[model samples]
Target: MHNACLFLGAGCNAIHRMSTLARPACLGLLACLLAAPGCYKVPVTGRAAVNMVSDEAVIKVSQEAFADFKKRYPVTRNRAYDQRVQRIGERLAKVAFWDVPAAEWEFVVLEAPDQINAFAMAGGKVGVFTGLFKIVHNDDQLASVLAHEIAHVAAKHVNERLSQAMAIQGGGLIVSGVMSTTGAGALTSNAVLEAYGLSTGIGATGFDRKKEKEADHIGLIYMARAGYNPEEAPKVIENLEQANAGRAMPPALLSTHPSYPERILQMIDLMPKALEIYRQSSQKQAPQLVK
Candidate 1:
């Protein structure tokens, strides 16, 4: 009986190994078939990316996930504050398209007073915490945050990151199809992985210092084009530093974003160009406002 049991266990292990090896080939074939012809161009950077998922699908998922988020957390009902955020967000959204185009933009402010975070999901869903509002003192400063987040969406950073994660983790086809059919489920899956930093572990890391720098650079341009002062960009970082001082940094920011000093330096390096853009935009707006 012992020998018979040992033989059965060996057979099971062999079958498991065979199944694991077969999985990748199946995913590879699916990835190849799903690979369409058109390419996506990132805004501001103008860098080309492969269009794996449709924009409509991405938007659908974003909206669903955003709705879920709102239900899970409290949404602020400060009509005045909400309207103000909407105004600034709309302005930045216009500038966001200088590199992309015609994004279906939406912004919401959550009532989470303890969560000092903000994110722009795959489509145009942007969320801000009331906690973040405590740090932003003015419209220009708010523009800085909005532009940075919008940069992520305009670049389709979330989609790119997810695709890379799927490919490396052997879930490429499943993840892509899931993202299309059930946007909320895909985001929920991602949320779990994000909580444990699994994406970073699999070398499908999220934004690094380089990506953050790119966002700062591109975001400065967006804010400037939207008629906000580019100088407000660095100010936003300073505010974050002050707000987070002596407290443990949020895991989400630490894992996915650049350190404050690095971001500040990048902002300083781009200041000259950003200042020039700011001046040009100011001149254009001055004439229009005078009319």
Candidate 2:
């Protein structure tokens, strides 16, 4: 009887000690699992994605981020380049052909001569840097890059990525609760969370590579439908490959994207379908190109 009392008392004492973080941790875990990300199908590819963020919230966040970016780097006012990009972008925008209702898509030309990158924001904001003209060659290649950037959003990669991060964080909290119950010290428990966090960060690259391949597959179709040759995609890849060749490279898995050859092969494999879309678009092309 005395031993049972002693054990019960000790158990109660341990629970009291853990109450600070452990109780809240348990509640946090319950809330996380109950409020798990909802799955939605992306526009063209139909890949089911788990994302907790609402469309309204996503757009709001994107708008804020975009505004900050523009403040840091103003849009170019060069009339000729702006008109040319707007022309091609408008055409490409018209033939985007995604199931998702397009956001009021906006295009901007950024006059950063040293910046060779282009990006698509989640809410359909796209920026193409002036330096890209050095290798883009013409409208078709530019279309290829734009299509690829928009495909990233069409595929819901950003939302899915956010979901992954939330899951990792939730998992860490759950584990912390378990550790607290096991009488782990704060330092030891924090160390475990840190280790798991490092692992989570590294694992994120895997999905990025998958999203890249998915974007490449859809981008080709988008550009083809916009009346550009699907073959132009491979040319862009070749340019990227040549540019990256001299630079030191990371291994395939650790890299955020596939190697140029891997990406080129993926585009090549999709060429037949993309080519058919191109032919159909060409048949329906304006009798005279848009002025």
The global C-alpha lDDT for each of the candidates, from Candidate 1 onward, is: 0.64, 0.62
Q: For candidate 1, give the lDDT of residue 14.
A: 41
TM-score of each: 0.71, 0.71
lDDT per residue (tens digit) for residues 12-120 in model 1: 2443455543433333343444543424666777765544445565566666666766776677988866887898888887666655565678898988888776777
88: Cα error in model 2, Å: 1.9
Could you say which candidate leads in lDDT?
1
Off by over 4 Å in 1: 1-39, 48-51, 98-102, 171-206, 249-254, 282-291
Q: What is the clash count for each candidate, in the order shown?
A: 0, 0
How many angstroms is residue 227 displaced in model 1 relative to the true structure, after the best TM-score fit?
0.7
Residue lDDT tens for model 2, 209-254: 7678888888888888888887888988788777667788898766
Stretches off by above 4 angstroms in model 2 are 1-37, 171-207, 282-291
In model 2, pairs of residues that clash are: none
How accurate locally is residue 276 in candidate 2, as Cα lDDT from 0 to 100?
90
